[model samples]
Target: MKILDRYILTSFLKTFATVFVILFFIFILQGIWLFIAELAGKDLDAWLVVKFLLFYSPNIVPLVLPLSILLASIMTFGNFAENYEFAAMKSSGISLKRAMRSLTVFIFALSIVAFFFANNVIPRAHYKFINLRKNIVQRKPAMAIVQGQFNAIGNFNIKVDKKSGENGEKLEGVTIHKRLPGATNTTVIRSKTGLLRSSENDNLLQLELFDGYYYEEITTKKPAERKKVPFAKSSFSKQVMNIDLTMLNNNDMDKEQIAHTNTMLNLKELVYTIDSLESNYSKERQSITDNITNRINLTLSKPKIINPILDKKIVDTTEVANTLAERDSVPDKLLALFDTNEDKNRLLEIASNSLNSSKFVISSGQNQVREKIKSINSHWHSLYEKFVIGFACILMFFIGAPLGAIIRKGGLGLPIVFAILIFIIFHFINTFGKKLAQENGIPPFLGAWMSSFVLSPLAILLTYRATNDIGLINMDNVLLPLQKLAQKLFKAKSKEAK
Candidate 1:
């Protein structure tokens, strides 16, 4: 390798490493804040918390990697240009493109690595992160019953004075406060002892209480009876109740319900999932249509003449004659069939009921279809997102390297400012596109790649200007209009004075 390429690559790598670490740590802190619920007061050990963060950390790389490359490239090149190293290279007959050759190769390789990382490592990490969070409460429901403090599960607030057993399932001196429906009153229960039990495969967390008393405050509407506060008391020898662990751990813990979410699947898995979702969605839509069609067909095609099951032929013949066949008078004739007002009212009532029923069916079907579309769209976005991550690396590098040369400033000052503004735009566009795509506002392909498509031209323009050593913008062209406006105002002011 030439001294120039080696020097350039080394400089970029040093800056990239520094920028990456800082960004990565900052984003990881944000992730901790996001999952603070799963970490705090859950009685998780140090190793568990570390694993949680480790699993979550890979998800942050998508946010960190591109910004790091952008900032690092800008700072490295800005420093070179600011220090006149670029000028020395130009004087030595090396072009800007030639100088960027080594770093370009590096960024391209980094992009590919980013793609595979998203396809493989990040999905696995996300799967683990979700499972760890769910399993913390699911696999160990006993953790919810902390001793000496009130712990809330569903509607029951339980406080245990002491816990002693294998897995801390036994509780002594238990107090419970339960809230009744409608927030009308509160129920207080005291037990001398209790036990919490849960099986590995069970969805219910069981609480068995021994020697407990229940007390509830009651309310009455009558003025005379309002003076004395009514109350109810009950006692039981052994009370056992089951609390759904699925609710306690959150609905996401249900493996059957959560397996199809976009974050849990890799590329191949996503392809299969998306295909299945779309197929099912189509079938469901068709089924709904067919159901409505069959209902209409049955109602319209029913036999007008009644016959006994034992008889092969109808006893009486029914005939319908068209009183008014003209299209314009068809509505009047249809209304005329209900000759009396009472019959007309009954007919209207039946028609209203049918309308409402049809409306309900259509509305429900629409909502279900929209939900399916969103799920399908989410999977599609994830499918293309694996490639987007890789392309983003190259996109950011091109943008940053040329921009740094154009601006000709280094260190944490101007380069950082430009990097932040540009990165913010990139991130915002990416998020907006993905969100819009998820809602089926645009195609998934465009949404996933919108940010890259929007910024590619800017990268090309910057690289061109930097290669030619042109200023960031044409100062003369921009200033001429402003200068003319100022002169026109001055001339008008002079004429008014005259």
Candidate 2:
């Protein structure tokens, strides 16, 4: 039994390792393609690119590890069943559960390691990956400028029709648009030929143009008085410009700012964040409620009634009569309210004020509500994700192992298909649930574990079928009824035809 356990364990681990490497490499290549725009044609150093990929590699581990586990489990168990090893073990009075015990223990240990990786290692890797990418994005203007496109360096937009020479230092048909500070007009420089170089310290870009024209538009103080806006143009045989690189040089963001992001926090940090956010939300809600209540009370307490009888009448009775005397004038009945309308005006003013205050309160309340929901969802998702990823690995192993045994097919052909289909379903459910949680449509725990809940029952069913030596889909039971029904229908049709 010990020898048998060792053999199965060894084979399983070997398959796991092989699948993990293959999948990881595939995903790494995919990442490169995904970020090709950012990485390619940037003239980045080879080592910098390699380091960026290395930092980003850990981000894929959580996604790929579970997938590899699924595939490897399926292949290992399918191969064993295909070779009749499981039958031999059963003949020796070893039950399926006993045969799986060693592998199950090993899987449990792997889950623990996976959890630690997700908690400890992945966060730091994420931080480094994000900052490195940001730094790469902030590479010097010379490195970022591409030919035949408008490239922004500081406040200037530069375009080169063609770039040549060994280091791309020679430029042709160069155009630069420089916007002056606090001015609407842009300084445009067009050159038929140019030479480009960066300072030794890369603090500035030196562009020297030949046989070019410079144009600037000056805005007049009064556009209506001027027939045309003033403008200046100069044809220059030689021109030089230096673009400051100070903004691009400061590429590094505050480390603390990056570290505080949700992706860069581990389980412990996530828990702390959730607690802090919950506390803050509680206080904010309390404050909002109190403020709203006080505002409402003040609005309600304001004296809104005015005595109309004591107010002076603006129009006399004779004037009202004169207005009534004119046929085209408004009738005295309609104009009567104008003679004593102070109270109505006061009431209208009070109502308008109350409405405005109410609108402000409602708007503030809605904003606070949304902010609270977002904070809570973010923290909760981060917290459950730590455990969910780890548990998913174990659950996937159970599913794949039994499924493979029941199917009794080995190698990549069927196993890979089944693994991918199952994983797709899992990934889709997990994503949908997370979105629901983020939107506050469901509890965070349920949303986080929704995938596991859905797959667990299927895993149990597969395990049961494998243990009983039954087909995965019970094809005989399913197809027998359909076959009988078809035969009966065909017999009835033939009789009718006869």
Which candidate gets the maximum TM-score versus the true structure?
Answer: 1
RMSD of 1: 10.0
For candidate 2, lDDT tens digit of each residue in 111-148? Answer: 89988988898888889888877667567568666899
Candidate topping lDDT: 1
Flag regions of model 2 displaced more than 4 Å: 141-200, 205-243, 247-259, 289-361, 483-498
Q: Candidate 2 has what TM-score?
A: 0.72
Displacement of residue 384 (Cα, Å) in model 2 is 0.8
TM-scores of the models, in the order given? 0.74, 0.72
Evaluate residue 448 in candidate 1 and report its C-alpha lDDT on the 0 to 100 scale: 95
